[model samples]
Target: MDIRFLVTFMEVAQTRHFGKAAENLYLTQSAVSARIKQLEEYFNAALFVRNRNSLQLTAAGEKLLPFASSLADTLEQARATMNEESIQYLSIASTSNAWDMYLKHKLDEVKGHLDHVSIRAEICSHEQLSRMVHEHSIDLALTTLPFKSDDVEILELSDSMLSLYCSVGIIEEALEHFNISIDWGQKTNEALEKIYPEIKKASMRTGSLQVALNYLSTHNSAIILPAQIAKELVNAGKLHEVDSLSPLTVKCYLIYLKQSKDARLKKFIEVFKGMIENQQGR
Candidate 1:
């Protein structure tokens, strides 16, 4: 039996839909179906059954699940180990907001501290981060929210303050910066909605900070930004703090495989945390 057949069977089993499995595997649906048919023939057992438009595994498939999963994981681990031994490489990734809020600033510092290892930094979706970390495709992942996975350990990194800013200060000197929440995670979004009900009515909202800043550079709307960055822009006379709405507290999180103890990843985490502390002290 071909390993590709097992791989296709696993994908189909996981998704329970040939079309979805094909899309994820980047193969034609007919190809995926053919592979599954070949796999069933090789096993001399029907692996799946269709009922009420829903796909389900037969007893044979249920028994094969553990073996298939173990084989695929072992093969992937072997490939990753070979690549790591050949290149001495480490990969880190994050959602765009988390990348900007945490890892982006300290990446160069991490590179310097881990100069002997090659680093690949990436911006990816939360799902991609979770999947890559679990599959050993990425060494570390930073996120605005933690992933609930038995395969990975979740680590709380730091809480970053995001403030509201505009092009000009309001006439209210009595206003002071206060703590609020923006849409970094489920909790934050709920908090934001609870506190500032009007935020829901705002005509413009965005996930990318760069887009907000570019819009604020010429427009009159407010943008939520990291407090440190907002301060620097304010000092440069490019933006002003909008102190009425209060700042947002976004907690950073990290995810990595539970079995991983890579020294390069360990060193990068330590250096990055120290940098955050130093920046806070300043």
Candidate 2:
């Protein structure tokens, strides 16, 4: 049996909701369903009795839980041991949007600050970053949403402001026709929903404003961008800010475990946090 199938089972069993399990495990619902089906087939028994309001473990599932728990614990310890061997290199990661907005500027500079700094930087999703932090697989993560946890320190930084912007030649009367939609987090989304239902009607949706920035150069389009970045483009005669509407404040957070069993990782996270605080004038 694949270990991942067991892990998926455990997450589903704990959450009792397939959609929640899929989100927590960074998997699609279909994938989680497939794994559960495979696990049930392996044991030749129904593992979960699903109903409208709840999911209960069957007799076979109850029997498998203890063994699964033991194996998963051992597997985690083994994985931790493997991670220790790579302690010479600390891993830091963030969602692609967060990295592009905040951390990308300091990537090369921070790598040289500490010894044993074989820093591994990756751009992944928010759920992936959260899992890495909980598993002690990565030293730090930056995300658009605050990951609240008693075991982690979340530093909220309000260094970004998002506002509507338009290409230099875009016609004001056609604002709805040129929408470049991007998910700018919950608060921004709510504010946008009130005024820009056209965002939903937009044919172009992207995660990065860089795509829209490139497109806006030749094509007339409207996009939301960090106020500072939009200012730079406006000064360069590429885009203009739409001042008729209010701007949204967008915040990003830096996340790291409050404590780490790995001594090297602990020290590095401390240094990185201090660097971030200093940059924000905190």
Q: TM-scores for all candidates?
A: 0.61, 0.63
Off by over 4 Å in 2: 1-87, 148-150, 171-174, 214-218, 244-247, 259-261
lDDT of 1 by residue, 61-118 (tens): 9999899888888888987987767656778898887877677776787777666678
Best by TM-score: 2
Query: What C-alpha lDDT do the candidate models reach, one value each?
Result: 0.71, 0.75
Top model number, lDDT: 2
TM-score of 1: 0.61
Error of 2 at 153 (Å): 2.3
Tell me the lDDT of model 1 at 9.
89
- Show the colliding residue pairs in model 2: none
RMSD of each: 9.0, 7.4
Report the lDDT tens digits of candidate 2 across residue range 1-282: 777778888888899899899777755576688789989999999999999999888999889888888889989998799778764677788887778677777676577678555778898788888766765557788888877566678877436777778877764754755567887777777788778777777777776667766666767787777776677788988777775444466667878866455677667766767777787784
